[model samples]
Target chain A: MSLGCELSDLQLDALRELMNIGFGQAAAALSEVIDLRVILTVPKILVLKPEEVPAFIDAEVEMPSSFSMVEQFFFGHFEGTSFLLLPEEEGRKLASLFGAEAAPLPPELETGSLERETVVEIGNIIIGACVGKIAEILKDQVAFQAPRFIEAPVDRSSLERRLAGAKDLALVFKTVFHFERQDVFGFLFLVASEGSLEWMRAAVDEYLGSLA
Target chain B: MGFKVLIVDDSMVARLAIKGIVKDSVDSLAEASSGEAALDLLAGGREPDLVFLDLTMPGMGGIEALKAIRSGHPSVKVAVVTADIQARTLAEVRACGAYEVIRKPADRAAVLALVSRARGEGAAP
Candidate 1:
């Protein structure tokens, strides 16, 4: 079923600005964490049916091989699950940058343990900053669950499974963060649950009203 | 006479927000979505006393645009308004001749203060 909520051009523009601000904060936090220059693309916002989200991601993300992903759920008036996807090679490069000094891994760790831990830590920072900024600007509060590391190839069915409880529709905020000097980048997506539509619209309107 | 202003940002909402903040204070206000477009406007004979620019745009990002503005229109003051608040980025923009750097989710008072400065008036109360 559709969410039956259609946002106006102005509303969508407002949401896009919100995402830009959110991801901009995320990039800043990430730069501090990794000590690399972080640049982000112009963030995009779209309202889509829950089932269509996977295809949209596949088209936008363009991962050639297996990818590393971190999923974290945020709860509050503006609730959603945020996904951070990095190509396997790039993820490895990023993990390597952490080295023993930044995030010392146990000598007995498994093959991909360092990569997993690195992505989870990075995901926590990116998702926290993005969602936290958006929530704060919209005058709402949010809390996040621990991030889950996913090492599988991303497929339609698997992605759909990530949206299991998100009935009706979802608003996807997508952006790519480029790690300058390191040549590593990742796609960040925030899938707002259908339940957030009404509240989101009201919050956005209120935000615009303040600007007016 | 009120000073002319230009707002450069890819996001329409951001343009609107800044415009709303400085609209009453400025004599004329113009907006462009990218660095290239902002230059085009200036070349097209739209000169503003102050330009509010965003750093992370699609093409010809803010730093390049700032340098070009400094070269061609040395009198026009450019303020970098963006979410990329890294120390390096801030230092680079300042070195490139940005009149000021305003963080995104643009704060109203800060924006007004910049406009006031641009108008040769003191900080906004």
Candidate 2:
């Protein structure tokens, strides 16, 4: 069943607020790191079948020929993968903000390229801050895997294959990031595993109850 | 009699959370979803003794709102409620004339204490 079917309006609202606070903290963290004002859109929560994510991303980003993606896994009461996606041009702009040079590298050395390193660092800071704050608010503990940078064209099939490990449903939390200085924009997608759905609902209720 | 309080934030949940904490302690409560809305409430003559404002919002954010309230309604105390607890942010709000800054996911006792303090202070003269 869909999250909308399972969660009431108030519950959804609570979830949205939680994400807002989480992303607010993330923005602050990124701001301090980059010394730029980071503006984040309110996070949109959607329950989509795993296969639908690629189409959603394609529609959102207009399916650039190639994009930079950083994939990281978080585990806890809320467990899932988080992806930070930026178009190649935007990624280059972000890398330049970090003073990364655009020297050409051979395929073998591309894995350790400075641009890839810069993007991964940005992804780690954003994901860690957002997930950490959410967990802190829920009073849950989480651990994260190393972020992996993917520099390749992300087609529907490729993305679907990557999501093959996800269960029947994925709870996707999407937000856009705007870095004021460079006017760089990126998309952050947190795909919660099916296992976390029940816990998520319960946690939100518990939080609301505490407030009451 | 108790003091009137205004809870301002873009998130309905946040406003409700603060409201739940201080509703019984205060005489009256008002809610605003944005800084501009909060300013409008004050401009329209809703004179709350204390205003709990959130910093980040769509338009006329907490800082600008705080400055306007300080200039227009000097007696109205404002407490910034935000998740952005950076030193710079806190210092900026204080410099802008916020009486206090309450971190988001606010603690109930802290909120109560702030309300109690506001009541005592507002009650004076």
**Residue A96 in candidate 1 has what lDDT?**
79
Which pairs, if any, clash in model 1?
none
Predicted candidate 2 versus true structure: per-residue lDDT over A21-130, tens digit per residue:
78778778777766766765557777677777777777776645466889999999988898887777777777766653345555676533756877898889888988
Best of the candidates, lDDT: 1
**Runs of candidate 1 exceeding 4 Å displacement:** A1-5, A61-65, A100-105, B123-125
lDDT of 1 by residue, A1-212 (tens): 44535788888888888778877777777777778878777876787777887777678756554568899999999888888877777678888776633745568986488778888998898889888888899999999999999975755677778777677566777676667666676667677876876898899999988887
How many backbone clashes are present in model 1? 0
Stretch of 10 with least lDDT, candidate 2 chain A: A98-107
Which number leads on DockQ? 1
- Tell me the deviation in Å of residue A186 in model 2: 1.8
Candidate 1 Cα deviation (angstroms), residue A23: 1.5
Docking band of candidate 2? acceptable
In candidate 2, which residue pairs clash? none
